[model samples]
Target: MASTPGILTHWPWEPLGNFKYVLVAPFAVHSLYLFAVGAEDWNLTYLLTFPFMLWRMIHNQLWISYSRYRTAKGNNLIVDRSIDFEQVDRERNWDDQILLMGILFYAVHWGVDVVAKIPFWRADGLLLTFLIHIGPVEFLYYWFHRALHHHYLYSRYHSHHHSSIVTEPITSVIHPFGEHIVYFILFAIPMVITALITRTGSIVSVSIYVTYIDLMNNMGHCNFEVIPKWAFTVFPPLKYLMYTPSFHSLHHTQFRTNYSLFMPFYDYIYGTMDKSTDTLYETSLKKPEDVPEAVHLTHLTTPESVYQLRLGFAGLASKPLTSKWYLWLMWPVTLWSMISAWIYGRTFIIERNTFKKIKAQSWVVPRYRIHYRLQWQREAINKLIEEAILEAEEKGIKVMSLGLLNQGEHFNRNGEIYLERHPKLKMKVIDGSSLAVAVVLNSIPVGTSQVLFRGCLSKVAYSVVSALCHKGIQVTSIKKAEYEKLKKSLTTQDSSNLALSEKGYNQKVWLVGEDLTEIEQSKASKGTIMIPFSQFPPKKTRKDCFYLNTPSLVAPKSFGNLHACENWLPRRVISAWRVAGIVHALEGWNVHECGDRVFDVDKIWEASLQHGFRPSGLIPA
Candidate 1:
């Protein structure tokens, strides 16, 4: 089995690593200088740092993209290249949109600032303004930042940021443009509103605050740690009141706590801060559990049953298992046995419930046996099933199917049953013993989902499960024997001396009807046209094929005129009628009128090719 990617690893102790110290030092020095001298100039700061920030952000994205490409190309790297760039780009665009919106707001603020010409407000006549602004600005920043992580939006947007579990400086600003815009707007809003309303605006103070935030953000994402051990103890409840690298690191590591960035006060007040900060480092130092309880339970049993077993065991072991007498050994033995029995009983219950659920969901539909000897035909069947499921979902119908037994159950243990019971999904198992039945049942349009898995159930079961899952159907697994029988039937022929390859026999057929103009045909053939058909065309196309302009008389006659053209046309066609595109089109024009009872062109062509059907100029070499 492939090892889980390191990017998924969660370590708590040394969260921000060395970067935290690096960020704090510069920030502290700059802040002190500003405080002591009351410096007014910010141009030097912006000129020196903004370009670096932009460069770091771009460099990080390029590295990530390159890493992904290399991994896909089969190169080894420090990190797994499973990051989805398309998703990242989408998220980044959203962030950019938000950022642009924020810039607009900033423009409005600029106008207000000029019109009001507010005097700078300070706590100590001049300094108090800076402190007061920092507090509320940081507070608002934390609140909006926390809101972004809410479940409603995390999967689609914030997940991209979390994709880089191991933070790098570049990854810090790689948020979707929308999120960046929102952050900018929120960060500026407090300061802008205060300055406008109170007639006290300090460019120097706001610039300091923004610079501090930027440094802090970079430090939080820095892969190194810089904060000294003594600072936690010496800085007046620093560990509890102020944000540190470790605190921010915890936010990424756990993903559910430590939302505050500049301070821990808000998180503590809201009861969102994890109380195990000191223990986090210890936990990281300890050897990882050989078998995490969650993983084991998901693989072996349902959570409900696991919980019940624990409850029963606690009930049984409450008294002293070992006492200072003969009762000591006897009581301990009794308690252990009771606990074991409870565990065993719980497993049995889980298995039983699983089976019951499978049985309850089973239904039969009319199915046609797919000749599996033909690979293309089989693919056609799979494609049809995929489209049908999508169509059903669009029409508000729930399609259900059995999943791969072992893995399906494993996922269930992981608390991922939404796939099984999505609004447009459901699944049931056929008797576990009959793979043939399962496969046959799958082809029928029984619910809105029009596919099933039967033969070679154990071998192809996972494929079927994945396919159905991709189409949003819940799947379950049936018995092995049934799948085996189905497989044998699919491979065997009733006629003698008819040994067919699986791909040749099992290939599926699709009837595509299109009213193609000459340009449309050319474009479609070039794969540039997006037709109304639910199915997209495969990347490869038949070579040397000529377009036939024959009128197809297929019923449900919405398909205007059908055209049939063939590649590898014979060289010695004696007449003009035979070579003419119009005549050739007319030859097979009426085939579509037969509905689903059409002849197998691929099989017929294969037979003809074997029997010496030769083309002069059209043969694809």
Candidate 2:
């Protein structure tokens, strides 16, 4: 364990394993003095140490990137790599970094006195200067970082930093220029004030402090566990004093904790240290072979993003010319959604759970599905949905499914709207409607030619009817106009005898159209069975009637639940959940938990597995 030079020599690169962090700040200060000021003054210390620090930074970055790629420990990474690289356009981030550096350092005309040439070694003065920088800077930064987490500030400023959960070297410096100005003012002002007040100020010391800060920032974002475990095991107190890549990574993944910059002392004092910080850090340090076969990374929007999106939604909904007056009237409802998001929409992670060889890690946005729908504000619903997909994609979610409402035919044509609108959203946006249709169709017995269609006019119901007819069932319908619409609409490829019949029906009935009571009243013969889409059966409904809705709507007795007809949701939800669960497990990708919270993939999987019954629909069509 001790003999490996690469492991021991690069111990600071490891997460939670480096105990010698105090030296890092001072060392960085010294190195910058050597590189930037070396040519001007020939000092023995400068000549010896300058080249090493410069090479160390570049070498560490290269080694970390190489190790992560070779080990393929992507699942264990705090974030997806694609987010750090692909999503953050290289040119833009580089431009931002270059601009900030040029303006802050080169572009500004600093007087010669700003960087002191005299190198004086004063042990007490050096220690005091380090303390001055650490104390006030940490104090001010804690508040500043916390302030940025606020809803409005996050969207406008801090969002750019949090954009890459799978952080990189550049991620350390990719702050919004506006945020940079503020951060610069906060950090520099305190150091400058401390330096002047102490009367031990030197350009060399100040440069060292700044260099120390930049080094720590890069180390915290390194995304590699270079620290050895022995450090923490040997001296437990070090955990509170030093920040690791895992510490900052936690801030990115779970934003509510570890906000302090260099040290976690403030985080502990404020009672904000994440409960799982130690455990998560340990988990991250595990070698690839030690972890599960598959690890999933989930993406969620910050509270600020939700608030911003909701406000945007309200604006779009309130657009007088573009939207319906009633939609405009729903401004209160839209505003209420924003409030709900504030109350409930905190970013969260579902602990990684494994099912056999596959692991499922779900990242959940706090906002409800209704927020994305814009609360009936149709004008902005599409845009909001597109933004949601883009957010997920930016977070590196490989596969995402939207709510049934968001992905319905009204909003999308076989996912074409999402595909066309967001060419950059490379992830799959599955509606699960195809699987839902398969499950719905499977509930019906095959080889039955004469079938009565109830909701033939509705697009979803029509699709079902068309599918049944294609499967060789002679589908009969009651809506004269809808039946004519289907007849005229069917192409040669979809040709089927979807008949309009007022005749007495003795065969099984597929209830999909509106006016369930009217259809029941108009039935010539007592149908063998009524397969309802969602609407509850009439009081006169026969005992054999079956409800075939996927994730069938639960109508409790308080809501006037009927006893005579059978609701298939009881049986249907199990199959649908299992299939989706298996898919999530097998693929280890993001599963969009849409619509009703009760029908989420997790709940469905638990219920389905407990029931221990596989419905016919598990097989994909």
Candidate 3:
């Protein structure tokens, strides 16, 4: 069985059009019945009930209409409201019609029972008949419902109801009328038989049963998880034995297990209940082609196999102890403990290695290793910068300013130092206190266009460019590497005679990069503008610097002087684990064990990849 469409796809609001008509038809019939019987007293109550029913109908209709209007206008009441209504309508089945008819029929039954006053005749023993009626009726309904799913019956009639996998409220009433009538007859037979046998009938019991059935049936088909957990908990055990969203949801998906709608005991006793709820009602019968070979490998190596092997040896060793059944049971217990210990140790080793690498870097401890790529973050920042630059450029501005200053102990009086005293790429030094760099760049704005800074300096740059944008000053990135690259790319014809002169360093183009403590000073001095970048939490601290000198236990026998190598072995192992498929399987198993029912295998894979696991040679091709 496959998973059904999401709940919202079959929301009740869609098929509300038929509700009013169904509801009115019942009341219309009731009104005629009351008039023919000359029941003037029941007339007022019937009139009141009509409006009550009408109110419910109108409420459903108005909600549906408003939702439709909102959807048509491309305004979603909730997130992810991108629905193809036409496609849904095209695929709609008759289940909804059956649901509506069922409700109407139940309502009419209740009305007839109320008008007949059957309870008045059996006032002394009414409760006994009610209980007897309920038991047999529930039993018959459960069996008949189960029978509908038999291979022969399902292909003929039942499949039509399940065709609309995601049931809409109106579609809840749209089942084939013939199926509905058959079901009604089957359901009513038990009650009628029990009533005859008991010799105690009650109109009140009939009315209550009919109303309860309609409400619950409607709820089951409503395609919404609106019922509270407490409601399910507090309801009688037999209530869950009948149809609920969870039960019905399973039925819709598998159409085999969970056949008993009014009682789960029947299904449980009949061995139809699926013990493993990992996939709920989803079909467990995997196609031969869909069964991955990896699953077979996993099963072969699972802890259960190891435990069985250990248990077999323990059982032989405990021959005398086996005479005492309780002592023999300890053999399996000891084996289970050994298996559990191995699993725990393996998990601990993996977690320890993962934490070690994360602790080695100043970078954030990413939720997943794939995030290290920083694709989305980089794209977003680039887009913002591009838009800002383009807007400024459109206004005839050529020069942009950036406000930045070197901080941290590695920096000298001149803002230049390798971040960690690296042997290559000596950092360029700049005067931290003086505004000379800003002034020089500001003067040659037209020729040396573009300024770039890390997000940490965005705010300061924003201040410097604010006045320039108004007066048409364009600014973009001016990093040395970028500048050199652009210079090489510029053609002689396109190149202007631009000189980086110190006089061009004017206050107008100088944008402060750090947080502005002196906002009043910045505004008062109209020449120099300052903007503050949004502050982010500091990066994680690296306790010790990693180099190639790290030794590896798995080094080749021919290798010499392993300690001389600069590569970090632990970091590589951590990275490998992050990308491993086994790690994801473990995570999935853990989530399921923890009782989080929903599982997304792809999400697990993506998270594993983001965390730093590269496949390398370890992953099977």
lDDT of 1 by residue, 1-621 (tens): 012212322212125542323433454355456556766642233232323344433444444333222222221112211222232332232223222432343345435534224333343323544565457766887787777677755654566677665453345665544455567665665455546555455544554555555556655554333355567757767765566544665676688888886677888888888776555433433322111000001111211222112112221112211222433435654455445643431211110000111110111111122222234544443333334333334433222222212112221221123333343342211111122112212332335332222222222233233334445443221334543443343323321211223222121111111222233223223212121110111122434332211111111111111111111111111111111111112122222101112123333323322322222221121
Residue 255 shift from truth in candidate 2, angstroms = 1.7
lDDT of 1 at 451: 24
- Taken over the whole model, the C-alpha lDDT of each candidate is 0.34, 0.49, 0.34
Candidate 2 stretches with Cα past 4 Å from truth are 1-85, 90-103, 106-109, 112-125, 190-199, 202-204, 290-621
Model 1 weakest 10-residue run by lDDT: 291-300
Which residue ranges in model 1 land beyond 4 Å of their true spot? 1-102, 113-130, 133-135, 141-146, 281-621
Candidate 2 lDDT for residue 197: 54
lDDT of 2 by residue, 1-621 (tens): 111112112222234322223334454465466677656544433333434344444444453334333224334454433331122342123223323332343222233333233244444455676775568778898988999788767766676667776665546766655666666776665445434455555445645665676667767876665556789899998887788877888898888799998889999999988888777677767745223222222222322222122112222211211223445445775567567654652333322333444433333344443454454655455555566566656665455544334454544553457676655554655554433444446557666666776652434455566677666667776668767777675665555667777664665545443346644644534435445442222233443344444433222122110111111223112223224433443454443432211123334434433433345322110
Which prediction has the highest lDDT against the true structure? 2
Using TM-score as the yardstick, the better of models 1 and 3 is 3
Give lDDT: candidate 3, residue 590: 27
